[model samples]
Target: MLKKLGVLAATGMIMTALTGCGSSNNDLTTNKDTAKPGSEKAASGDTGLLNGAGSTFVNPLFSKMFSEYSKEHADVKVNYQSIGSGGGIKQLTAKTVDFAASDAPMKDDELKAAGGNVLHIPVTLGGVAIAYNLEGVKNLKLTPENIADIYNGKIKKWNDPKIAADNKGVALPATDIFPVHRSDGSGTTHIVTTYLNAAVPAKWTKEQTGKSVKWANVGTGAKGNEGVAGQVQNTPGSIGYVELAYVIQNNMTAASIKNKDGQFVAPTLETVTSAAKGALTTIPEDLKVKLSNQPGKDSYPIVGTTWVLVPENLTLDKAKAEKMLTMLKWAVTDGQKYAGELNYAPMPKELQDKGVEALKKVKVNGEAVLK
Candidate 1:
């Protein structure tokens, strides 16, 4: 089942060590681009150095996409910092980075703070796996109620009746249940909490859903997806929600979560893509849409679309703005190919078209950049 679900083994896979709060400088080779010279070079005739920060959830995909993009446009260098979504938005508002990536969409206040020009461009979709470390347990199924209670600190034992009821034939241990969560402001937290709120609305309130919540005062707190995954990997009886890529990268066990359709679906490329169906139809003009707890029976319950945050009227200089828009145009189009290998679902054709249209609105001193 795991192999059929496309979960890669950890044996020969090499995990790239990304810095927690700084830019990655991994050396990559360059390739030639076929785009017109005007779009390729900055107006000032200087190299374009674009800096971005945010969302560890999309770090794996961004790493590959940026590296591949640099390969084609050697004159443009993108330095992305994986310091969670909140930090990315903060940097974007502060005008410190050329752009930012986030799993969660910016709030109304955030938009106003950035002069209300920020555009949320949907780039990729992915699932948040309920990763756990338990001896002799390979396939674990969890219902929404079970998950709510476990995270709320109400279900502290592995052999609790609620958990045991779901797995009748399995050997249940009496170990203490440790729920891990992100210590920093995280878009992964926002998705999980939002799903929890949707799944068990009575238990998980709307007030408790956001990039950072007061996490029920239980479990341990880790910094990023890497931190939560590492915590679950090292601590027995520990469970945490992380991106599907992290789960597969660490070769950790992920639970099959019960979706709104009453089906327990595992996080896989197909399942995550299934959740993304019809998302474009509901997305507003802003392009900020949620994919969690979608209605498909085959859909993974904890799926979300990650976006790149760029201002419609860029704050950067004309030369840098042109380069940034060009890079973004390529990302929503060509950059999507690298998503699946990194455990992310590429944006649907309709959404990609919408993204291209939105990118057309990006301007440098009232002049469009794409043309």
Candidate 2:
């Protein structure tokens, strides 16, 4: 049965340190403004404040990108809330934020509820690391079946036969396996569930894919990527799925998941980028696509793309709209250089071009802002 763990007292310290790395107040501007081709000039006396929420999956990159953008434009300030993707979409629909970010593209019904003018502009690519807390185990290998069963509560011990089969030589403990998941709505949840659903359909049904799912009565729930990372960090024999950056930042142990090509791939910039190759060619015109379980020898199995959601026809004042679009355009273009350092993959040139084109559709009061 599922058992909930209390939020650990040390979790706050871990999150504080993790988020501190990308604090907006820190001026570490090292890049030039190369967005001149479609840049917008901030009007005099404009507050130039742009507020956004969503996608803790993209938080590190967003923290750096927004900070750098503000450095280049003194008048423009960006405040992004690293809430889960679901909360961000809700804020966007409620008109409480200027933009929203999510790893999972909004569903058609969600799009329709927001006046049907929203555009999904992909900003970064990353892997959902299957992080675990097991002593004396440095390298762990997992298959889709092993994962499906673990979360399904069918595999209750760390040394379960299914898990042991993948790591033949490793001495796995017989400790009870604890699975941690997002307690709130999250796009990270979407990416992991989507991968599980596709990789092992019979075990992880389509009904389980989305921003949130009724996980089997096993494991506990944590609030954000940091929360999950912390849960895994503090609990021995626990396993959780989190964005790759958090795994890196926390120095947590991650598993090498076997891909469709039968190769065990670790999450890296190259592997995550490789995961997008198949999807890039078949991506929809809306730019809404999934990159999990792609057919490539080098592709990481749990990768996903994060997008910034902006209304095609903005309701903000002309100045605010112009500045907001300008910053966003920069994010998808010049801002990409900062992604790799934070454990995220820069968008491929093809996807970057499409993102720019989508941003061009944004208008303020029927007048195009990018032109």
Candidate 3:
């Protein structure tokens, strides 16, 4: 399959893209000739630049969304860094970037440290797939116990009875199992840990749920989602959890995790959509909520929602703020059409309306930033 549009190579290249510009909005310039009537560029003569960093898990989707957005509104440019979620939050707190994207919601300490009040803008919903690179494996079924034991070092071999029992009649290998995990602070890690904690309380309880966790001695660590996916693809008998987009991009074998209904469900657009529908109903005023291990018969077990961090008050030039707001509004509305094509679950219309309401609250000197 063709690599999804705008999915760039990860690691150092991510930072290079951000710093190469000298500043986030520096290169943006008014394109008077290309401006459209009633368009954001027509209204605001300011250079249309929006800078964001964080969540390698969402990088591919954002890359597609932003690229398609530029096609429609030629004046605006968005530069996003695929650094780990921790780096994104740090840059946002320091006021060095226009916004930040995080898979995990900010902790209380992080919220207190922000130079300006931050708002959580929920973006697309997705799932974390437990994918493996076994030479002859096909359709692996992992129960809650099987997953817990594999990560906590209780199960060392691919042919372990617990895993075999879940997939009867399948040939099982006696090779040692290598568990791969994220080395960086990441929302993907948080979602996996959160699911583990809820699905297998006894083992995952000892390890707190966060972007970074203490892996059992048996597991190895890799940097970003791309790093983990690369390690799993190259190393046989290795299993790692990553967003569904990576699974699709790499064509790796994903495991079916046992859900709350006791059915082993694979991560697909339909299952993840079911999970999001059940979880998005009660989104709090803050818009920070986890969608993993949701209750539903067909729901995938390890789903999560990603958020874009924006300031409640616009401290940047009003033109820049308006431009940023315009592009963001487009992402949740018109930009949603590209989501399903990329294997991401678009927010439901009702929840999207609420998200738009939150975006409308952004203001400059106590007035709405975008008219």
Candidate 4:
């Protein structure tokens, strides 16, 4: 039985702080492509900063990129608000943020109504680690079946023999089990449910569930990644899942997960990137390729891509709009170098090609950013 997280619980969240890797405080205040003798520099005649909202999952990484990007180009500033994916999309549709951050992509009609194209740039890759706290338990490994059992409330204690069976020689505990989950419409929840649905279809389903599931299991509910981290840290015998970034930042012990490739891999930059290896040249003209449970030996599976939501129209302030496009271009290309150090995967070369192609659709004065 998979845990349905839609319900609430009373507890705390445990988070681990892993120093972000390859992060740079490099900023580009002004967009200037020094032209060759006769080459033209790309500019929209607008020079200012841009502000964006949505996607708490990528907030840490984006913040690093923005801060680094700000150093050189004080003229332009990029600010991202971690308001969660659902809110991000709503903000994007409402024209609130210059760009939206979402783990998930927009739907077809949603794209149409906006009268522009949506590009899915998977700038980073990571997995949701099931963090837990227990007595005398330093390292706990878990398979998909065990995760399913715990969330389903089928296994109720830290010392379940079934789990002991899998980890074989590790000492088990007797603490009461507490499960933590998100309470908002999160892309993180969507990635986990997508994994459960794939690994154990009979118990899971074919639904496009969000970060917080209709968790049938009983536990506490937190607001965002930070909220869940707070909940788990305060509670004993508590287990909750969040992106690898949070797990590292909070200093929590994460469980080993079985991936679609049939190998049980721990959440790491290496594993996460391996799982994202085979994405299509163009993410389905519709963005429905579930990256969880992908099949491969090195593939850790259970991965998710963070997407940038840009509006097709230049209906907003011109200076702000150009700055938004500037950040997107840099983040997807140069800034990606920092992904691994942050425990995230960089976009694959081919996939980046697809991304660059999709970004071609982003326009200002009928000119493509890639151009």
Candidate 5:
């Protein structure tokens, strides 16, 4: 259950303050790679800077994309802040950032607040991995009922009968189970909650679902995906959720999830790719679609697609708008090659073609930004 942000009626000054809270200035720079003696620089000189912020889930991927993008396009620099999805939407609604990235699509009300002229371009697909820190528990499999109950403080011990039923052969420790959760507003939370709600409708009531939800007063809370991962790593018998990439990079153990086909599936590039296949068939004109609980036997249960939020009617100065659109176009096209290395599923060819069409629609004043 994603929070449907209401009309943003904040004044210009308030918007500026909100923007400053995340990044000191809009025009920030990252590492630069010097050009070789014979390499060609970008066509334009002093192309204005591009600024964006949002979605820690996609931050790791963006970091690589932006850094590499800078190496080739020295004339323009892109700066993106890895704030939570909520912060990104706030900045976008306030019209402060040049663009925003979100793992969850913006709601209808959010679109209305932006003058109904925004575009959600699909960027990548990933799974919401359920990672744990159980010593000697090499493999773990979780059911929707168990996951929902754990977060709600119902299942308190690692050796609980229900858990033991799932892991028949593994040794069960009688240790207390700690459930770590994201304290900040996050798209990761939304995806997890959405999946829980879908998989266990009777238990995960609508009221208990959101990007920010009132936990069951159980385990401690951490600030970001990194914080949750760190907490689970340090605290034995702790379980937490994060993007699939974090689970890999942190060397944490992830549980196999029971998919719609009644098969236990682990989160991997192949399984996440299976989930994205479902999204490909049903994506709408708005490009907002859910990828969780897909029907395939191999589809990971908690997967989601991340998106880039750009204004349909561009208002930036010609140079900045041109540069921004060019970079965005490259992000969906050439930049996709970088996704797999980071455990993100690149948009399939059909979706990539549609993404290209969407980016092509971005216009300044009245003319198309790209040919």
Candidate 6:
């Protein structure tokens, strides 16, 4: 098997001939003259850089970065596929991609199958916001339990008292509650379900923990964050969960979620940062962490962190892999600069340091992948 499958080549990409995962690295370059319009060169390299696949949630961010990076580092070309996290994980396990972006980290059994050298790099931080289009009643708030009940079909109307309870005097319209979900494998769904599993354990079990869930009600499925955002915006009394950026970009109304301390926390860069600050520095090598009911009183209970997948250990293709790591490392460091601009929180200094250490574990050419 060719291994590097599902990677789509961009037309008129103008990027230098990218290397690795079927992209030719030998022709990599750092010249803008080589890449197509909209792509910028970032690093000085001989072979065009190659990276692709995973997480539509991070798609806009990385797409922007890759385009900007191509200006100075035009020699390296970055191509990514928004094929959803499930496909990204599949491509990664099959050694088909240079890197895989995922909102949900890989599990222990998955790590073992990866054979030792997977680098779990959290590039940027964003929150999944509950967006809705209601008539007249704009200020909407929901506890995790309330959200759970809505998704579980327990509460069928937007004016349910459970929802109104959180809003106090806010008048919610008496409308049919329409819940839109992702049709594709999604980390956004994972984050939502994970929170649901915590706030409503009986409803959100292990079976419902991943991307797609079996809901008691029939909800329409949208393809990705963009689709869901559009669907929710156009449909009155419809609600959906997507990265905060989507909500902001789409100009949709976001619900304030109940925090661990019982305060309604609006999904924001600051609140998500507050939540991630509650996470520990010492996560297992597998990068799996349960994010629900965290200790921080300010922490938004529904917050989540995304992970990028790489080879388990350094490999003969270390140089190419380093291109992936270096890009990711840059995404975490400098990437945070743009995060706040895009409504994403920067990783805390503590976690940032730990993440740098974790990057060291991303090896190249049978040697520890260089710093």
- Measured by lDDT, the strongest candidate is 2
Residue 158, model 5: Cα distance from true site in angstroms: 0.9
| Candidate closer to the true structure by TM-score (higher is better), 4 or 5 | 5
List the candidate 1 regions with Cα displacement exceeding 4 Å.
Answer: 1-14, 17-47
Candidate lDDT scores, in order, read 0.80, 0.81, 0.77, 0.65, 0.77, 0.67
The residue-by-residue lDDT of candidate 4 on 161-181, one tens digit each, is 988877777878777788988
The prediction achieving the highest TM-score against the true structure is: 1
Q: Could you give candidate 6's per-residue lDDT for residues 18-128 as a string of tens digits?
A: 111111111222211122312321233323557456786776566556766766565567766666676677666765556778888777776677675567777777788
Error of 2 at 38 (Å): 28
TM-scores, one per candidate = 0.90, 0.89, 0.87, 0.81, 0.86, 0.81
- Cα lDDT over the full model 6: 0.67
Question: How much lDDT does candidate 4 score?
Answer: 0.65
Residues 269-349 of candidate 2 have per-residue lDDT tens digits of: 788889888778877899987799999999999999899999998888877888888899999999998887777888888
Q: What residue pairs clash in candidate 1, if any at all?
A: 31-71, 55-84
Clashes of 1: 2
Summarize candidate 3's per-residue lDDT along 230-251 as a digit string, tens digits: 7788788999997887777666
Clash pairs, model 5 backbone:
none
lDDT of 1 by residue, 287-357 (tens): 88878988888989898878899988875677777788889888898888877777799887788889999
**Poorest 10 consecutive residues of model 5 by lDDT?**
11-20
Model 5 misplaced stretches (Cα beyond 4 Å)? 1-47
> What local lDDT does model 2 show for residue 133?
86
Error of 3 at 80 (Å): 0.5
